[model samples]
Target: MTTTVVGVDGSPDSDLAVEWAAADAARRHRPLHIVHAYLSPFVAAQVAVPTSGGFEPVLRAAAEGTLGAAVARASSVAAGLDITTDMPAGEAPAALLDAARRAALLVVGCGHAAMAGLLPGSVSRAAVHHAACSVAVVK
Candidate 1:
């Protein structure tokens, strides 16, 4: 079945997006897929340090928490909604675009409008232009 894909990052904007996506999914009787892309500090640093004890676990935990919370919120917003979460390791836009490939709609949130000549945020703009499905930017 076609799904509604949303990108969440534990931000207020992301929360709004999740709610909007959930409502859309409910209206359309579709499943909702929430994704959060996390970049490991080690990978971001591009340096191979001792893996004995690092912040990787903390980062992963935080990402998991974010996804969980987002799922909860979506579930509450739309009872019986088939909601799922994915924590991909990479850039947000890339991860979102990948999820959108099989989605019927992709939803994202924007805090504010961009400059006259520019799009809102990189993720939203990129998804709007590259996603395989229609994209919605909730303000």
Candidate 2:
């Protein structure tokens, strides 16, 4: 069955998004797809100099680890919730939106748009505007 996708980045609003997504998935009787994409600082740190050794391997590992942790976190909140995780090698918003395209719902933290919870970044906004399915920004 089609599932719901939620993006997590270890923030308060992301936690709320996870809970909300879990409930929504339960209500819909569909699996929940929790996604988390992570990259190393040496890959593309804004304030730090990029490493010269390359970053593809480190980035892939970090993304895998982040996605695994996100799944574990979701399971801790709602055990046996049938959540499948995806860790794509890309920006969080882009990967999330990609997952959302196949999802019944896309959940993320509320961006600081004076509409809902104040997320500290613009990733949520990008996902909300570009998501192919219903977007829910949990407060």
Candidate 3:
């Protein structure tokens, strides 16, 4: 089935985007896919450690929590909606674009004055330009 894909980063703006995407998906009878991209600090660490110990787990847990919260919020707003969540290990924009490839629509959150200045947030701007499907940026 066609899906409405939303990128969430545990921000209030992303929460708004989730709400908007959920409603649109419910109305259109499409599945709602909530995606969160997590880039572990280890990936950026210049020196490799024998083990990350608790650090990697903590980051993964937080990412899962963010996805869970978004799922809960979406479920509350649109009961009986087909909702799914993803945590891709990469940059937000690349993950969102990958999800968008098979989606009917891609929704992302933007901050106030996102477009008034020189650039919108990098992820939202990149998704707007590179997503395979139509993109909606909720502010």
**Model 3: per-residue lDDT, tens digit, 17-130?**
999999999999999999987653335353332246644566678889989999999999999999888987656778899999999999999853221122348778888889
Per-residue lDDT of 1-139 in model 2, one digit per residue for the tens?
8888998766667777888888778778889998876552323544342333455566566667656767777777677789888766446777788898898899997644221122355777787788899988888
Worst 10 residues of 1 by lDDT: 111-120
User: After superposition on all CA atoms, what RMSD does each candidate show versus the true structure?
Assistant: 4.6, 5.0, 4.3
lDDT of each: 0.82, 0.72, 0.82
What TM-score would you give candidate 1 relative to the actual structure? 0.86
Could you give candidate 1's per-residue lDDT for residues 4-94 as a string of tens digits?
9999877788899999999999999999999988654335556442344575566678889989999999999999999888988767778
Q: Give the TM-score of each candidate.
A: 0.86, 0.74, 0.86
Quote the positional error of residue 53 for candidate 1 in Å: 4.4
Clashes of each: 0, 0, 0
Stronger candidate by lDDT (1 vs 2): 1
Candidate 2 vs candidate 3: the TM-score winner is 3
Where does candidate 2 stray beyond 4 Å? Answer: 40-65, 111-119
Which regions of candidate 3 fall more than 4 Å away from where they truly are?
A: 40-54, 112-120
Q: How far is candidate 2 from the true structure (C-alpha RMSD, Å)?
A: 5.0
